[model samples]
Target: MKECVLLVFLALCSAKPLFRPSYMTLKNMMLKDMEDEGDGDGDVDNSLFPTREPINSFFPFDLSPTCPFGCQCYSRVVHCSDLGLSSVPSNIPLDTRMVDLQNNKIKEIKENDFKGLTSLYALILNNNKLTKIHPKAFQTTKKLRRLYLSHNQLNEIPLNLPKSLAELRIHDNKVKKIQKETFKGMNALHVLEMSANPLDNNGIEPGAFEGLTVFHVRIAEAKLTSIPKELPSTLLELHLDYNKISNVELEDFKRYKDLQRLGLGNNRITDIENGSLANIPRIREIHLEHNKLKKIPSGLQELKYLQIIFLHSNSITKVGVNDFCPTVPKMKKSLYSAISLFQNPMKYWEIQPATFRCVLSRLSVQLGNFRK
Candidate 1:
């Protein structure tokens, strides 16, 4: 009986309780098993748990019917002018025809920013803070016609411009030079305005405007001391005012026979060759205000179609008979021809009474109104 009790006590003491794992331990073991199964080199068995779909499998929500906040939209035309915006609006409709985003704070134009807008014709981004543009920014917008990028901070002309562009205005920027390929494909470009830049004569490449048939070219305040050679023959209006041009040679206006209006005001022109205006037959208006002319140019009398001549703030001391007598016949036919000689030294000089009467009467006979 003693031996049986001893054996029962030893058995009871050596026996172990049932091994039951906690809920947290069981969850950890199951996760480890799943991770090991996933890392296996063989194909995964999807019978236990189904696989989930990717996050980007669905299409984005539709936000194209309405314009961006603080913008006005009317029949596919969006106007976001002066909105204090810092970047291009993200919610602009892809089918927009015209987008006016002037007077904004936009800095850069990234690639594909204007994608999928095939009908976009006009884009106005003037008076903005644009600094850079991606190379493929306008690759999708091939139908763009008019682009206004004036009054910005662009350092050079953007490349890969659309060939369908007709009018491009990029005035008042920091463009230092125009490369030969800047407007390579721009065959339809008619009007180009690049005023108020630091462009010199060397900045333009030879045959820069070769393939182009631009009609109007304005490069005022560009620090040009001489006339740019090889100008477009189809030019009708040329504005080079507020420059450093000191003289007009005989062949300066030789190629510009179709030029109607020529602006050379506020320049340092002290002398003009007698035959400078001989080539321009259809010249109507000439602006020579605030120049250093000591006497009137002799070629002025030959311009038969001359209507208006601005010679104010010059150094003219007297009027001669030959100046007004030669052009009396031509001026008598035109009813709108006038010569402005205000704020000159002639106003303070003592003119001979006989000479003044002869010149004044002759001018009065030609022009309807004569004022000295």
Candidate 2:
């Protein structure tokens, strides 16, 4: 028995980590999403969302029209990405549906840049050096839908964006303040990603998200110290991970009734006010990993549709049977799919199986090996 135990211990020490330690796995989630969407080699980015949703809205063809000098033109798409250009190429075909201008040195977008692209559906200007955009730059492209302006040097959201826009990725910029009516009349917008900016709570003006029905919004890696209350009430997914948020208050999520997926991981969150999550009765996934939480937040059992709860890499020391599931098991609407409690300080042996009675199975529950 001693010989077998020694062999097992030796085998364990030589084994590598089962999962990537810092890859942001809310079920294999974002940050990787940003890379997949940043690739320009593909004809079209299959992933529209910076997290999960795939891009299925565009289909490029082989019909070539009036192409710019050094750009690739095919179908109704113009591919000018990854070039060392300093300005928007001229004579772009009028019927171009999508323009790929990412990874360039373009510094400004003047009024005549997109002067005649009336049929333009998408414009990608990511990974550029843009600083100024004329208020009327996108005036003629009134039919534009998807816009990728991430990884730029913009100081604020561009003015006079098309009201028909659906997905807008302006993350990884130098934006600070978001004035009111910034997204006004953008009723068709559903996804908005603005992570890696220097925005804070005070910089966001009152009613900043007014007139927006955008559902998925990611403001991760920002300087925010608390949740922005002015976000759209129709939000289904809100990812604020990697911010400086220290607390989750009751009023922070009072108006978001349809919230489903929430990402608050990698913050300074020490406490989540009781019933703060109950306001959104339909919340499904909650990413609270890598925070300073001392215990499981109160009132989780009252949530009917809660499935995934990421509480790993925290200071939790205990687990109660009724803390996650209601006393009456039938009150639960959905079975817990995943419950991550790794990297905490809790004693694994002390946690009983009854604690996860609502879970799908023991394999679905990730526990044990709580390192100090």
What TM-score fits each model? 0.74, 0.82
Model 1: ten consecutive residues of lowest lDDT: 47-56
lDDT of 1 by residue, 179-268 (tens): 888888688888889999899888888877777878889999898898787667778888999999999998888888898888999999
Worst 10 residues of 2 by lDDT: 48-57
Give the alpha-carbon lDDT of every model. Answer: 0.76, 0.86
The runs of at least 3 residues in candidate 1 whose Cα sits more than 4 Å from the true structure, single-residue gaps closed, are 1-64, 324-333, 347-372
The lDDT leader among the candidates is: 2
Per-residue lDDT tens digits for candidate 2, residues 281-336, read 89999999999999998888888899999999999988887889888746745788
After superposition, which runs of candidate 2 have C-alpha atoms over 4 Å from their true positions? 1-65
Best by TM-score: 2
